[model samples]
Target: MLRMAAILILALGAPAAAEPLARELFGAMAKPSAQAPEAIGTYARGCAAGLEELPESGPTWQAMRLSRNRNWGHPEMIRFLKDLSLTARQLGWAGLYVGDIAQPRGGPMTGGHASHQIGLDADIWMLPPSRVNLSRAEREKISSISVRTEDQTSINGNWTRSHHALLKAAASDPRVDRIFVAAAVKVEMCRTAKRADKAWLQKIRPLYGHNTHFHVRLKCPQGSPSCQTQKPTVAQLSNGGDGCDETLQWWVTDYLEELRNPPKRKKPDGPPPKSAKTYVMSDLPRQCAAVLSSR
Candidate 1:
């Protein structure tokens, strides 16, 4: 009986170390490629492995907010940025100013973004980049301006064709799954883009609070069987749009009403603001935990 009790106690005490919350583990990740490059799970509910950091500067582009240490992404996303930077200059833009890509292991972000949990999403500032060499302090000090009016009714004086050209270059990329921008930016695109370039309009998705920068997400890389792709949104599922559609009209109506009367935002329904349950490790794919555990 004594031996059995001792065995039981040892068993209970064994593996007593608590598992770290997913957000906590991911947040603490300092580097990438702890393992092979593998994007696992859905965007909001996913994590990635084998992440690589983007170079701080290139011939035509420079990254910002380096202190965040979010200039990392999957190899495909890094390549996409490299190609897009070159293309932007050729498309007559001065250069590109990139923002966050992903954290090293790519899990639930403690700060901005409900997505970008995988290595496929990135944010590029709308601020035109004329100079490729910007000091860390300057990069942090400079702010991107919203193209929307103060009232948010429509594009403001800051809106220019240069913005359109930059967006077009990003949307035109075949590897790009979608680009999220403000409704006003989409409305402007619908009004101005020539018919020949309208196919790219399908990839430009209008979402809230992207007036100062555009969000770009890439499609799953070929041969990535474990990577989950998103289902088609109503916009993507419904075919055939030259950008002039009821969707755009609805956005305009919504914008007008909001300007006249902004609705109150509801508090989130869930565990308290910083509850550990905020990021359920099991909610992510099994592979993600493995990614975090690797070197």
Candidate 2:
């Protein structure tokens, strides 16, 4: 009886076996092959360590939730937000959204093509105070704020000249990688923002698109072995004359198609080339005084 009782106690105290790490886990989070575990015990230990380092608050943590569908971004995405928030504040913009809480009725998801699932990407509403002509109370309501789907259209109407300035400011910030704005707005911004600051315009252009709401992308944080690297490109201003109306239309169509039908993952045929430098607001020509004065 004594021996049996001792055996039972030992069994009860022992830990249960750990589960294996799925390949999807590594792919989704962009983990490198070397660090991945071969055994279930090692994998669990790694996961626990990784989770421990993740933030408990902020956009990435706020956005995290268990779901049947696969979309949540990696844990490092939280760190990216903290950095972005600080950078954006310096340039005079408000906070970012972890999800599509403020997406206009029929507007794209908050992250655009990048999955908002992990909360690394966010949408910064281009609420430029100069254009809205709203009272202090109204401005407060719009900043770092979210709205229901029903209220999206009304908020979009608020995108004005001041908002454009704010967007330009945000794009010019060194930390920002890309921004998506409405097509008409993009055209208008391309004209003036490029002129106002050539470097900023170049940084923002390739990352620019025609979403009703603005999407902000930041660099992948350190310690995340799985992050994708994008090469920066030189700034390319849209020809102010609207000469590429057909090209714009085709680009939008193609972008939407890719969004709906994302390509399957495959090994590249050659070494990944460096990403071209994007056209941010600062890249615009200084000589275009006429563009800024008109705005």
Candidate 3:
């Protein structure tokens, strides 16, 4: 009897098997929570409730990679994408080829992003649609063209005035917070923009690996009190001026040089930082538990 008791104590004292990662839990959900819509934390660390799915195909847009089922987003994002697709028509393109927005419940995804966790971000393909009626097979096989050249120093022939007009219209929208594109594209826009009409250029930020598509992030919708708004960048904080200066030049110059010859550094002597893939449920906002468990 004493021996049996000792085994029971050991079993009880042993740590429980680890809970699955948050991305695994959220990614398994194929539907949004049954509660009212809310964005519950920062873009990189949060979950959303009551997300709506964009239609697989629309009159002016088509959601790509339907197999991923990542076309879900907050209603405001759906409206914004539809509106932007219509705007693309004015530039003589058929419409936009919409990319991933977020998973149905908007938590850390299984792969492919660090953000898109709160349902206000989306990817718009640089490849304008020749037609919005692409077969599912065609979308999977097709690819977007890079506006910048392979060297990353300048815009290639694929970049056009229509692309400029489309980007300007998007950045000028009151609902948008910022747009991310390749650095070279921003430099070209800065060069060609009229001095009197350059205010919207400030929203066009340069980031690495956006040569094939641009990312659009929207402001928090009016009703989401728990949503965390992203802070402005240093360029945006500087007197509301268009970001057309030396800082922009660094991407093609010093940034490229570092990329070509990366400097070695000592590894930090601790556990690695948590990212979307590494996050567990506790790493997300408390309310995410409700979002994840809700039917």
TM-score of 1: 0.86
Worst 10 contiguous positions by lDDT, candidate 2: 37-46
Per-candidate Cα lDDT values, in order, are: 0.78, 0.35, 0.88
Put down candidate 2 lDDT per residue, 166-251, tens digits, no spaces: 56666665655556554445545555554434555544432333343566554444554433434432232344432234544544
TM-score of each: 0.86, 0.40, 0.92
Better of 1 and 3 by lDDT: 3
What lDDT would candidate 3 get against the real structure? 0.88
lDDT of 3 at 271: 84
> How many clashes does the backbone of model 2 have?
38
Q: Count the backbone clashes (under 3 Å) in each candidate.
A: 0, 38, 0
Error of 3 at 291 (Å): 0.6
Per-candidate RMSD, Å: 6.0, 17.1, 5.8
TM-score, ranked from best to worst: 3, 1, 2
lDDT of 3 by residue, 41-85 (tens): 988999899999999999999999998999999999999999999
Rate residue 226 of model 3 by lDDT.
86
